[model samples]
Target: MVKLSNTEIRKLDDAARAGWLYYVAGKTQDEIAKKLNISRQSAQRMVALSVSQGLIKVRLDHPIAKCMDLAQKTKKSFWFSIV
Candidate 1:
């Protein structure tokens, strides 16, 4: 892999921001590319990197607990339980 310079790192950061603002935030890729003054492919690649780096996190709010009391209370609060 090519070592990135400070400038290039800054560029990468800009790319990351553009990617998150566009792809993850539901803005169009074209708009992101245009805003970043880069090609659409570059924008897409940045988004891919964001995911690969674990910067893009996807989660379900279900909690796992060994405590019976907490589990029972949670189950009572929520209609659907996933314990």
Candidate 2:
């Protein structure tokens, strides 16, 4: 599991909803903002955060395995010790 900052954790639900509203329900950022009672910029940022944080996948056409490669590199860089 990935660790989340307090703010990121708090936004997870909204981010998921925002992405769904934009992608599945076909809502514009302005519409989403109205529905979610947030600023349009917040709506847009939530949609992007959902994708960047992997809260949801807007499409399945892209390969997620490439992300796994980056994860491995990060683990090697930060968590592994030289022997």
Give the Cα error of residue 60 in candidate 1, in Å: 3.3
RMSD of each: 8.8, 7.9
The C-alpha lDDT values of all candidates are 0.73, 0.87
Model 2: per-residue lDDT, tens digit, 1-83?
98989987778989999999998889999999999999999999999998998877644455886786678788788997433
lDDT for predicted candidate 2 compared with the true structure: 0.87
Listed in order, each prediction's TM-score against the native is: 0.55, 0.61
1-83 per-residue lDDT for model 1 (tens digits): 98989997886687679658765778777777888888988888877776676667655455443465577778889866855
